[model samples]
Target: MLTHPSDPRRVLVERSDLDPMALPPDLRRYEIHLRATFDWGRAYLTNPHPDLGRSGSVCPFVSASLKRERFFLAVHPGTPSDPAEAVDTMRFYRDWFLELAPRSQPSAQITTILVLFPDVPQDAVEPLVDDVQAMLKPEYVGQGLMIGEFHNGPPAKSGLWNSDFRPLRSPVPMLVVRHMVPTDYPFLRDDPEQARMYLELFGDQVPAQLRDQVERERAVGAP
Candidate 1:
């Protein structure tokens, strides 16, 4: 987690006092930027090397909005030195999602939920649909949560959670772009295309008054 030495009061995980069940420790609150990127899966933190090891990191967490940048909530079991333990840990994450999603706030729900898993196929997660539903009640605003499988190497369009694998029928747009490999800056950086795409899709969130100013500021790399 990022920390600030100059301002010790600036805490990343402050509301740890909330009911953990409804607000799990893994969930984080962030002010979502119109064109900013969120690292929910902590793909970069888990996979330091883009070439070797298991597929990218599976940040087993969920996000919601309380009117700010973006929030990330997740649990890190301290890297497991044992391979078997790692697998078990991941399996636990898959199972835990069942409990976490439902506990999430019904009103502060996001439009999209993306889950990136290991090499496992959708079939592995298909059986958990019932569990997923139980956790995510009908009131949830998102069309549905997307679950995808990921692996290491160059970026590929195929995975358990790939867009081609399980596409969303509803207008709600949520994607889990897993980095096949890791690097210093693994979280996919926002490019011009991505920026424009976000503005088009989530432009509603951008206040009309600052919309033009925001565009102008970006053009000159301000703020």
Candidate 2:
């Protein structure tokens, strides 16, 4: 069901000229596919999806810096397959993203850091994903950084009325970084405190009905 980026149908980022050791085959292939894939609400390195303005593309600066994507791979030296090391790697990347993403000039801003772990195997991935989300989300939710993980874990089921079951799965293991938005409430809604935090951050822009729903849902769970 998945075809690699070398497929003639897909667009590529053209990273062939870069040093092979600095950008090896797998990472190079990732960069190529990233530009073609319709994730991140856009073809990351390709032309902007026409619907982006009406959809989830909040950071306009992202498109301008598409060719200059800011990312790091966490696979060399040793794999961070160990839970503790995974957390440490995530923390380090989080720090790097916090320091690097926002400081760029307005026109050429870096919205998120693409943290890739090209070496992690299937058995170790799910736990690492859970660890990353649990450890970082509390501190980063409203603070302008988001961490999104993609792996072979069974697709996450839909929270809304039945629609899709595995929409979040990816061909390779990936963790994306970007700012949080109002629409992310569904993903954070299960936790009352996080839901509260979401409202505090975006209540002005959230709809009255949805705001009441989030409150009512939280209040019902409160002991």
Candidate 3:
């Protein structure tokens, strides 16, 4: 839940409109919530990589099943774009997630984060990824997971299709998800042969039980 600057429920911080940092306290707080939601989802669904902070213990990899839907989004819809905005946005989400974790089911002890980029270019996304790597470099080296789901064409375009899964080099253990599967069933969304190929390539990294689970899940209504 978030309060608005114009809303009487908030204490406004008078400042120039151009200054994103100067937004009213309530707006800023709301911005944090939006940011957190996007980050949580992006990190969990796209990149569940473990990151090491400049001062803290090593972050463990977040299990996808546990961190299914959490994230952060930009708060100010009309705010001007800023290069470092993503990082700031993620920071806010991480803090908020930590506070809200105890309240979530199964408890939010998992080390995962999500992010959403509205109006951000792929090139712009690279640097933010780098920053995240640095902030959590230790966790990313070997145990990190990076997943991405590119929508392919512009949102306005019709009849879009997700690309095949591909590997991306980003200084971390990545599980990049290039396509957005349409069906709830993995097999229906992805070609059986292709998915099998991927299983063959990375199956060794996953536990035997987990691999079996994937097979079982995909086998549902699968030819």
Candidate 4:
């Protein structure tokens, strides 16, 4: 479903297409990272954990994405330490995500793209992974899309249910792109402009319990 065949910065691989034995030596690392982060790790993003507090799974949508073959992992061709290069690489995946098939409701919601930076040194993760996410997040929100940064480093953001638990941690440095769902209000609520954009996108569709919170945040106006 990847429309950008000419852009060679990354190679997109579907969850169902991952086969460690079949991959060449150079490409095998990507498969290993994906498996460790999403499969083998006990505290993986797709699996449910007791410490996760209220969650059924660390990410409720990942299991469905895997089963539906909608989960995609892109192997970045190089580990660019520059924030601008990282942002540009992510922007490529973002556009590819938007152009992917099954561009309809429900199905579209489960589709996600995780762009992996397997070679990025762990120490550089904060700037290359986290900072890039911070820079592109606003523009992504404006487009009704959500992007998240994940890495082997300590938790940057805590779980909603358990404050001490770092839910975003992963085995490899990566950026995830997915459609914005109504429940994502919590992420947007802290920023007035982001919150306003969420309200405009979801409006009455926002969950009844969170509607007041979104409106209140929006009322604060952009600072």
Q: Using TM-score as the measure, which candidate wins?
A: 4
User: Which prediction has more favorable TM-score, 1 or 2?
Assistant: 2
TM-scores for every candidate against the unseen true structure: 0.25, 0.61, 0.31, 0.87
In angstroms, the error of model 2 at 198 is 1.4
Residues 68-164, model 2: lDDT tens digits: 5432233322357466776666666566556555634452134555555556677766767756766777766656456777665744644243354
The TM-score, computed over Cα atoms with residue i paired to residue i, of candidate 2 is 0.61
Backbone clashes in each candidate structure, one number apiece? Answer: 22, 0, 31, 0
Which digits, one per residue and each the tens of the lDDT, describe model 3 over residues 38-98? 3443353354333321222212223342344322122322222653554354444434444
**Model 4, 1-223: lDDT tens per residue?**
2325775434666655558765545667667786765563334656788888885777877777878878777777567957888888888878878887334756899888888888887777777888888999999998889999888685479888888888787778888899998899999887878887888888979888787876676676646
Candidate 2 RMSD computed on C-alpha atoms after optimal superposition onto the true structure: 8.8
List the RMSD of every prediction in angstroms. 16.9, 8.8, 15.1, 2.8
Residue 78 lDDT, candidate 3, scale 0-100: 27
Candidate 2: stretches off by over 4 Å: 1-77, 103-110, 142-144, 157-163, 207-209, 218-223
Q: Rate the local accuracy (lDDT) of all candidates.
A: 0.31, 0.54, 0.35, 0.77
Q: Residue pairs in steric clash, candidate 4?
A: none
Question: Candidate 1 — which residues are off by over 4 angstroms?
Answer: 1-71, 75-83, 103-146, 149-154, 158-223
